[model samples]
Target: MTAGHCSDSGPFNSDGSVSFFHLPWGGIVGRRLIGPMARPDMSVADMGFISKRNPDIGVIPSIRNTDDQEFPELIIYGTLDSDTVGSTVCKSGYTTHVTCGEILAFGVTVTFLNGMEFNGLIKATHMSCGGDSGAPVFQFAEDILPGIFITGMVTGGSEEQGVCVIEPIAKLITDDIYVLTINDPI
Candidate 1:
């Protein structure tokens, strides 16, 4: 129920230093060409056909606090343009770095700075343990951007799937939160 930006998707130390999501292969990216497709749902689970983008090096987008300092605001987006609606989409986390494994996920609508609203979702996969929060959730595809959208952060999980929630990129950026676009430094 707290509100803050993510730090990264690695682990924290009692001392300092950090471990981040090293996307040597980079993450995925998605963009809206003619705006979102008419059948947004049709593109479900078909991230490979979308686009791809990578996360910046050494910097993992997260929502953690360090030494009493909160990082900048950040959000991830897919290729679905304004025409698309944010509903019933799948997201992939770090631990289970698999293809099309995320289901039954939805994002919350947050208002942006331009008075726009965005829909984001919380990950249902228990992929993140203790050190895997802030791991970006994206889709990879050919002829498309690599990093589509950063689904959510690891808010914590239960016996079921790992409990991770994400704030929509549209919301963070529009709201004037220090946001880091995909492929940007963490």
Candidate 2:
């Protein structure tokens, strides 16, 4: 899954029905576009999923530093549905790699420089910039489990420096979609 707008930017095929996602580790993953919600103001969670599957890559749930130098990739034990203000949240993006900050607000609506307005977002003090869209916003659950709980995907940055808006993962998930947790078979 990835930010819908991220697909909007695309390295699209001539038909525009598909996009190529580049990996920092070196490779390309072609994904079929599953169109995002159409809204006049974009108040909904800014996310979309790809229909294609990559069997070569491990499907185990995990999060790691982009470089895996500072911290190793760890399994995702499960998910957290609720978030509290002042709690720490971290994000890993194409541009920012990994950064953490406190949750400042919820149900935030943000307007990007492109004049695209996005709502139903979580506002955080994490440092972010362009190309960081579609990053994973997660919480470390070391106290309860030795893993992270993915909460949201980055929609974009806020006007305030060091702030970004995240679309809660819960809003993007559905009955047909299931996130792989530790309990799930790898």
- Tens-place lDDT digits, model 1, residues 1-186: 112212222143343322222332134543212111111121111111111223222334432212223322223433331113333323333444332324335554434233434345444444443333333444333343332444433333343434444443333233433335554654
Number of clashes recorded per candidate: 42, 0
List where candidate 1 sits over 4 angstroms from the true fold: 1-100, 107-123, 145-147, 161-164, 178-186
User: What TM-score does prediction 1 earn?
Assistant: 0.34
Taking all chains together, each candidate's TM-score versus the true structure is 0.34, 0.79
> What lDDT score goes with residue 21 in model 2?
37
Kindly give the stretch of ten consecutive residues in candidate 1 with the minimal lDDT sum.
42-51
Question: lDDT per residue, candidate 2, 1-186, as tens digits?
Answer: 777676665556566644433465322465333333321123465666654444454445776574665455756776676469988888877676777778889888777666777777788885664577877778888785447888887878755576877888788677987678888976
RMSD of 2: 4.1
